[model samples]
Target: MDSGQEALTLLLLAPLFFICMVIEYRILKKRGYSDYSLKEVVCNFSLAGLHQAADLIATLLLMPFFLWLYQFRLLDFSLTPVTLIVLFILQDFFYYWFHRASHHIHWLWASHIAHHSSEKMNFTTAFRQSLTYPLSGMWLFWTPLMVIGFPPSAVVLIVALNLGFQFFVHTRIVKKLGWLENIFNTPSHHRVHHARNPEYIDKNFAGVLIIWDKWFGTFVEEKPSLVIDYGIPKQVNSWNPFVTTFHQWRTMLTLALSTKPTPFHIRLRYLFGSPKFADNAEKRGTTIK
Candidate 1:
């Protein structure tokens, strides 16, 4: 499938997404759980709209380059059933690294933090995305697939499928599945992913398969005795879409561009290293928090 087909597929499934959100909202409210608030839901979808718009523009601009790069593919691949299955696994593997890097690298986190900004973990919470993802070089993660002889269209479709599968795992309604939780990324595993607890932070970066996390040693189980607090360590308290999207960008840029007497490498680390390093830099009064 090409970009047009990808968009069409998502458009057709749009109603299903809304239906699931409504069902989750009703169920949470009926159970007297405060997971679904009107304001947060609206903010989630608003950020989603901006994200979609930016993604569409980025896809158009970047698709040509991917197509041009496909000419010198290392291996030729036909879109057979077996190849599609292979593509799915490879795409998930790449997504896992992309997600892990987003957490560790301050540059990417400046965009990804918007998705984790919400304190609520309902179905609509999955809708929260950053419009700056394209700028943050998210599409770079899938370039390997394109260069390995998979059609750019096929890669796009597989990415869409991987992301669609992840949407269902954003809810708190579903408990841990039996053995499937060990293999697939379940709601329980995802809850741990979104949790702010020190043990949970930067864990469970699987997009479809949980095995990557296990093999890579980043997997952490959700503790029944522990309460999960959603949202980042530093919260973006504003509901304004611009503030929610660009707040981290402001912090990161200000820190990286500060005129302090620090070495150039430390300033570079502020832009490209972990948020922990950035926090330390801020604590030294090198930059505003």
Candidate 2:
């Protein structure tokens, strides 16, 4: 995972995204879903850039920790192609559970909700990541890779590649790929995941493969003619990323503390409950089809 290798890996994967985008745009045009205004596209691009910058800064700040892990033999630096592929698959496997937990665990959802806040499903939405994740123990999810002999650098690269693959799946341009859609996490699947519709909420948590969701009972097929309304039901419409990320968290903390005789279970649920739990539990249940 030297700089040259890292750069090359990104370069190689970059074209995949471009190709996917082209395919998506063409499909959207054919389906008459290509009604995006220039202004909206520009806004989405700007937000994506801002998020990328945040991720860059976060990665730099976390570099020392990764380096330290490598220096102490907490991580091994193997670079064979097979090992790298295995690491990539393993990372996505862990990512699946981490993502699933973020939906079920209240505290983690506070940090993860930003990525789901967009009403429009596109590649830009895929870049809309939360800056609060590092503070929320996301790095711990990858520790098993290190413990099992994957190098920290390799793990980081594989993780990045995994994420890069997902960017293409956020768009509405590409529809179902028939069998491919069933076996993989496509835009169709992810759109359902992002939907606030009762049947769509909390489904399709895979990062790369759809098998994880199917095996775990979280899979849901896209229902044709049923439109997806994105964003949390209680929308956090603020453009301020910080507000969007922490507002729910703050409210949840207050609720947890204010509730008298709060059992550990209630506190836990407060952290991970559906976004509308405080307003209407029955509604939240109904919202989740």
Candidate 3:
């Protein structure tokens, strides 16, 4: 599917998104949890708009490259229900790595940080995406599916479905779903992913299935005694959509410029190294050893 049709697929689901958000908002409000705010919701959807626009433009520009790259496929298979299921699993596998890398690599974290910038974990928090994903090379993660002989359109559709399924996992409304939690990414698991708590910081990177995290040793069960604190380590501190969207990028650039008279690799590290490296370097006024 082209970007237009892919967008329509998401659009058809927009009402569902809105309805979930509304229900979650009402429940949280009645329960006396201050998870939603008008300012944050507006900013969240604003970032969503920016993210969608960026994705649409990037998809249009990169479709031909994906198509050209498809010619070099190692294998070709017709799209069947079984094949589609396989593709979905493969896409989720790739997404697990992509999500993991975004946490570990500063370059990608600059784009992903915005999604975790909000302290709230309402349904709208899932809408808080960064426009910098295209620049950060998120699409490259899915190119492997194309090279593996899946049609680019099929890959894109599966990606949309994967992300759509993820929206439900962002809420705090649902508790752990017994056996479902064993195989799927539940709200509890995702809350751990969004938590700023030490043990939860890099855990639970599953896009849809929890098995990837379990297999890779990144899974952490939510602790009832340990209250989850949502948001990144360094808070963005602003509800302004633009500020939140580019705060980490600005921070990364500043770190790169401030660490001056250093080796070229050190400067690159400011942009590409772990975010912890950047944070510590900025604090100590020197590179991480």
Against the true structure, what is each candidate's TM-score?
0.96, 0.78, 0.97
> When superposed on Cα atoms, how far off is each prediction in RMSD?
1.8, 4.8, 1.3
Clashes of each: 0, 7, 1
Measured by TM-score, how close is model 3 to the native structure? Answer: 0.97
Tens digits of per-residue lDDT for model 1, 14-109: 898989988987888899998877788788889988987887888888877988998979999988999999999999999999999999999999
In candidate 1, the residue pairs with backbone N, CA or C atoms under 3 Å apart (3 or more residues apart, or in different chains) clash, namely none
Cα error, residue 163 of model 2, in Å, equals 0.9
Look at candidate 2 and tell me the lDDT of residue 74.
Answer: 48
Kindly list the per-residue Cα lDDT of model 2 for residues 1-289, writing each as its tens digit.
3423333555577677667656766777778875444554554555555555555666667667766665555445568888888888889899999999888776788778878877778665775676677667687798788777787667777777787778878876667898898678988998889999998989999999998999999999999989889888777766665666677677667766653565676666666675456436333432211
Rank the candidate models, highest lDDT first: 3, 1, 2
lDDT digits (tens) for residues 44-117 of candidate 3 = 99998899999999999998999999999999979999999999999999999999999999999999999998
- The deviation in Å at residue 29 for candidate 1 is 1.1
Candidate closer to the true structure by lDDT (higher is better), 1 or 3: 3
Candidate ordering by TM-score (highest first)? 3, 1, 2
lDDT agreement of model 1 with the native:
0.88
Strongest candidate by TM-score? 3
